[model samples]
Target chain A: MDQEVINSYIPLFKDAFLLTVKIGWLGIALAFLLGIVCAFILYFKIPVAKTVVRCYVELFRNTPLLVQLFFIYYGLPAVGISISAEVCGVVGLGLLGGSYMTESIRSGLEAIPVIQTESALSLGMTNGQLFKNVILPQAFTISVPGIVANVIFLLKETSVFSAISLMDLMFTAKDLIGLYYNTMESLFLLVIFYVIMLLPVSLAGTFIEKKVRFKMFGD
Target chain B: MEPVLKIEHLNKKFDDFTVLEDINLSIAKGEVVVIVGSSGCGKSTLLRCINGLEDINDGRVLLDGETVNPGSRNLTKSREKIGMVFQSYDLFPHKTILENAILAPMKVQKRSRKEAVEEAMQLLDRVGLASRKDSYPRQLSGGQKQRVAIVRALMMNPEVLLFDEVTAALDPEMVREVLDVILDLAKQKRTMLIVTHEMSFAKAIADRILFLDGGRIIEDSDPKEFFTSPKTERAERFLRTFEYEK
Candidate 1:
């Protein structure tokens, strides 16, 4: 590609990178909230929720994310449920991230012994207090690294939304390619944009994993 | 004197497995009752039922003048009057010893942080762990954790305290320290029910000792008579194993 062309595309790539981050941030925030609620439901085994949660987890986790995204974006709107493609993308990613987050949080919850819950109950703590004060803090600390990794993964996964014309990093790259007919330059720019946007998050995930492991396992 | 606790026909089952069956016992006000039994004989379960930690399938658990019901949604409120220490100590690993000790009083009793910490410091001092108040459970020794747990339970100012083999997890040398603390509390006439395997400690401290086997109270008597003349073969055999340990 020409140096002049590459220089002009840098600004476009920056815009795409920012859009990717916006989608990732919103997706992760929603995922985190849903993950915590699902984790609690699974942890306490509320009513018939254990089986229902198990089915939900298995269904989402076993299926491909592309199919889920397609179903939400293409299938839902046909039935008069007309959510924006951007909202659909964020919600789809959030639900997907929540599936992974639920497993992470549940593992964290399992690492805490049942004796802790019993002790909390014996102390006469309200159920709300027990969940808020005793369980959530420990579970969050234990799940932090996994949740961070999920967020990073979800950041990369945001590229899938481009398939539905969300104007994310990949979508903008495609638009640039169509305009200039320079597929190589646009493709290379897209790769660079994703790498630049995600490298810090990847490093952050690794750093947090190390810190949590150190705190959990000692020195 | 009115009975402080009364257990009549106390039965518990986990699916088809019976943990306790036909347990009828009573403790008078200020009396110390020590339950000595083999593992899986339901001594701990019995104490748990009394404190509303475990629900009995069919039975009556009366604490003071009121009937204790674990089935009720408001059982936690009722549990404020009863405190329990587990064998594993079960201190909240995330909390410091002082925080663990004061949490119940502050949350359940609505005591001020200053008041709760003041009470906790006194209990810590009583348990010989005033210096370790800032330490987490993971930082403390097993014996120290159990002592802190005992102090934590006592901070609730419970009418009845249950110890489910609290010293069983400690080292042999450390066992005496926990026992000494319990003995001191007993001297203060704190209404206590201890589920213990340490026969010597039971023989020394129990105002009355109950020997359990196969989920039934085979023998209930004072330490002197209970040790000297066990009526049931199961109690005799159970006590015989401790003779070699001593």
Candidate 2:
């Protein structure tokens, strides 16, 4: 644990941390959007689209993020489709996270009692209005815990972004260890930065879960 | 005067088991009709069928001379004219009582928030829940929640209101408060079709009492006549059970 080595590594780790946060959040955002859309598709049981979304969820959930990244970055290039490494990392993470999100959200949607739907419809709500106003709000509240978990899982999954040459936090740590061989300092900073990324997310998640539960279920 | 709602030869079945059969009835505007029966006699199913909540095997439901086609775009428009409150007091658990009351008016009827909230406040106040407008459903007693459910249905100002066992799920003490709200509506001549096991409440609130047995209307008469001297033996036997329980 050399003080000089640790101080020198700070700038590199800072840049890597910023890159990880940016890509991780973007991927998580994409995952949430994809998850909600796919969940609704399955919830409504739309004919062909439901099967397609099911297959997409299964395909992504079953495969590793590393393989998906490799396929997007290296395998697709074989077919003359070239996506940059940043895009590859974000897309790979989003595709993988989307599957988990779909299941999480789908369960939330299902947890709503049948009476809610009946109550909404009986109030003269169209299918769209009922879903948007009544179903989605309750379903989202029910989904907060699962969604927060997904966000954290997706953020941690960003560690594999190095496979696509994204220069994320993991890449910087690995590069520093290879060059300086300061295994202790590099690894320590890596753990610190990763914790810095994940701790707030988990804490924020718990806070939100509590707040929503209180709002929904009351004191 | 034309009826506000008319059910003609309605038949509903699940797979092969018949739930509602050959049900035909008409409700005039401002009439309070209470349908009472033994458990599993299709009272709730009849109300669900009237609201287009249950898919009918055959026959049609007409509101103001327009047909309601279940699972069609027409049904959505038609549903706005018909309000229903359920046994479960299905107030959105995540929403405040105010939000639960105003959601359909603001979203479905495209009313402004100011107007919806104003109307919601008035209704909530009428139901003695004005102070709890900001409270979630879980915070309220079962009786209070049911009152909120009633307010939510009334916000839509439907041509006809259907209550499917609204008070059946409430505590014995909570039952009167909810029934009083319906009685108030009955006094206002709000068209309502209620299904309840509360025989005395039915006698007090109903202009007409429908006695259903085995998925058919066995008696449709004035409340006094039906209660004191039921025409059908089945009605006599049904009323006897309530007496037996009492």
Candidate 3:
């Protein structure tokens, strides 16, 4: 309820919000790329790569993002491989998000009826053409909801970046609370900023799901 | 005249059970052959084998004198010339009718979009579905979707057309619309191998009737002769089943 405290924290929250958005989006983009590739590898059952991707998915999915980030940020330096806090945050989030993405996309790919493949093949589509024109588009449309959820999940996971000295929104809020004992104002701004970050993505996801379903089914 | 499609000793098995056994057949150019029997008679499997959809356990299929190998690179090329319309009217649900029709022509045949679309529109118009070209598959009735499927197959200008119970899934009234389309194609002397339980439609459209029973061609004779005086007792019994319905 302190107007002065809230106003004073605005500039700091702004900087943190921008940083969070930057790293969060970068991580999500990387996650999407990794997810698609890994999903295809598993879907097609490509020889050794399938086993490798399966292990990768299991490993990342079972471990918490917090733990993964800890390893990348804190444990890597002992092995003589040091990365910037920003790089560590992005890489950790990307790896974690990618596993969930792979499952989401793999489910989408599997949900496509076998008849679809037979139809495409009967039409004389080469394997590559079938995958590109027929399979990928349908699978992607089917996975939109899951992919969006992963996006939001990965963005929230960026909060843990504070542990590695990244000045993200959560770090900013906690720092303010600890230094100035302004817990109420800081926590209020944190909640507002998080909502600002997630609300549009959630709405966009629902809009896209509806639009795609209508386009596909014409209802 | 050489045969457009030839199957020699074609055998298909799923583990221990044999689906098709030693099926030898040939289809001439511009011929209309209708294969009819009870369900599980391998009629659909025969069409699938000709199109290289299923891997045969023995024997080979030849289209235009070239082998149709299921696992070979030439399978795609062979499939381009063999158009198949399924019972479910397997039109791509995501695409509009026009897109579904024009896809194979554009992507597989490498035809220009304008050319493919132009051909597709004409074919759709032929099937009385030109007005519904922009509609998705789910928006159309079963018959309309089958018509679109027919247009999609015709867009390839294939050497042979295979109809695997194309009207079996349609409503009683809708069956006529799809059958009429096939009957029209028959008038054009298009080479087609159709598998259907519609005995009357089969008799009307078929130049030759192939009655399959237990994975073997029990009878292959002129439609008039086969309809009137079936040689085999099984064919007599199969025809008797249809008579009871009438």
Candidate 4:
């Protein structure tokens, strides 16, 4: 029972944990914001941006998150656009998660009846006002559950960062396993980390979904 | 007399399908006009066009002597002077009934919140839903929602109100309640263009009844003459198919 080896991994574990949190949280926030903006643009079909968003969604969604991450991390350097691995991870996750976020939000937009928009228009709301005041508020509320779920999935998917040597949680765990060779202990801790991090998100999603459903349909 | 709403050869087409064609109508101020037709006869389309909700390719809708330009960038401002009630009520599910009623006045009319709420409460009272102001649309029945819809339309103090089959979605018993609200609105002398299938309701309150068939105004007459003796064969046939229960 070498508790010393496990304890030695603690500082590395702390650094890696913070990095994962940093990348995941930042990535999730940026992705959600971009997703909502791009989704609305796509939903409303706003000129060339609409087509660009469409291609962006298809490009990111159709490809693997890992490949997308690798391309941003490794491929971009060849194009003379080298960014920090941390930046690469964040941007990669943001773009990948944004693609899915756009789809989720697009579905929310579709779920809203055209009658609602027509009603808003009849009430004298400009298109921008209609989206800001009516459509976006309702759509965002409805899409909350889906967005949170996607965020959690994206957070878990951050494990793919080990491939990019970003020194995220999984990367630290692999390092520990290589040295201490305690696969069970290290893997178990990683699972615990995910569950702990994602529990609040899962609960928040359920709560938000219930509240929106209640607001929309009542108890 | 200058009609509050004037439609000259109005036509609406959805793709290759013509929904409303060559429709001509005029509604004077403070007049109640009821448009009646079977399903897909363009009655709703006509109402929507007047409110600037539908695009009409071939004609113009003038409100208060000014042509309602649907394609213009300022259509929202044009629509601000007009309010509409749908068969579905279309209340914002996220907002309380009070918020739903007050939103247009506060946002579009630029009325202060206190002023807006005061006006909205008055409208709620008119619709007999003052106590339900805090309630959401989901909490209200079909008839109550329709009544609220009527009140919501009036909140803007619109010169014209468009009701597109407001009671069609209600149950048999619920229809009368919504119609009663419309009847009450009619009493206030607000110009209203209503599209409905309720023959008796039309016969009772409408200053003029318009029978639409194949996107044309087949019969436009006073209610008494329309119910007693329709002018067109299409009107007679439509009346025969839908008998009013005495």
lDDT of 4 by residue, A23-95 (tens): 9999998899889899879887899999999999999989988899889988998999999989989999999
- Arrange candidates, best DockQ first: 2, 4, 3, 1
Which digits, one per residue and each the tens of the lDDT, describe model 4 over residues B1-246?
Answer: 988889898889999998888888888999999989899998888888887777779988888778886787667877988889998869998899999988877877789999989988887887789999999898999999888878777887888998888887889999998888888878989898888888888988999998888888888899999998888888888889875566
CAPRI quality of model 1: medium
- Give the lDDT of residue A152 in candidate 3: 84
For model 2, residues B1-246, the per-residue Cα lDDT tens digits are: 999899899888889988888989999999999999989989988888887888889999999999886876688888888988888878888888999988889888899999999999999999999999998888899999999989988898888998889888889999999999999999998999999999999999999999888888888999999989999988898888877442
User: What would the per-residue lDDT of candidate 1 be over residues A1-219, giving only the tens digit for each residue?
Assistant: 777888888898888788778878898888888787788888888878778878877888888778899999899979989888878888888888888888999888878777888888888888788878787777777887788878888888898888877888888888988898888888888888888888988888877777655533444
Candidate 2, superposed: residue stretches over 4 Å from native: B71-73
TM-score of chain B of each: 0.96, 0.97, 0.98, 0.95
Q: What DockQ does each listed candidate score?
A: 0.55, 0.76, 0.72, 0.73
Residue pairs in steric clash, candidate 3? none
Which structure among the candidates has the greatest lDDT? 3
Model 2 chain A scores worst on lDDT over the 10 consecutive residues at A210-219
lDDT of 3 by residue, B162-246 (tens): 9999999889999999999999999988999999999999889999999999898989999999999999999998899876552
Q: In candidate 2, residue A217 scores what lDDT?
A: 68
Model 2 DockQ class: medium
> What digit string (tens of lDDT, one per residue) describes model 2 on residues A114-175?
88888888888877887888888888889988999899989999998987788988999999
**Alpha carbon lDDT at B80, candidate 1:** 80
| TM-score rank order | 3, 4, 2, 1
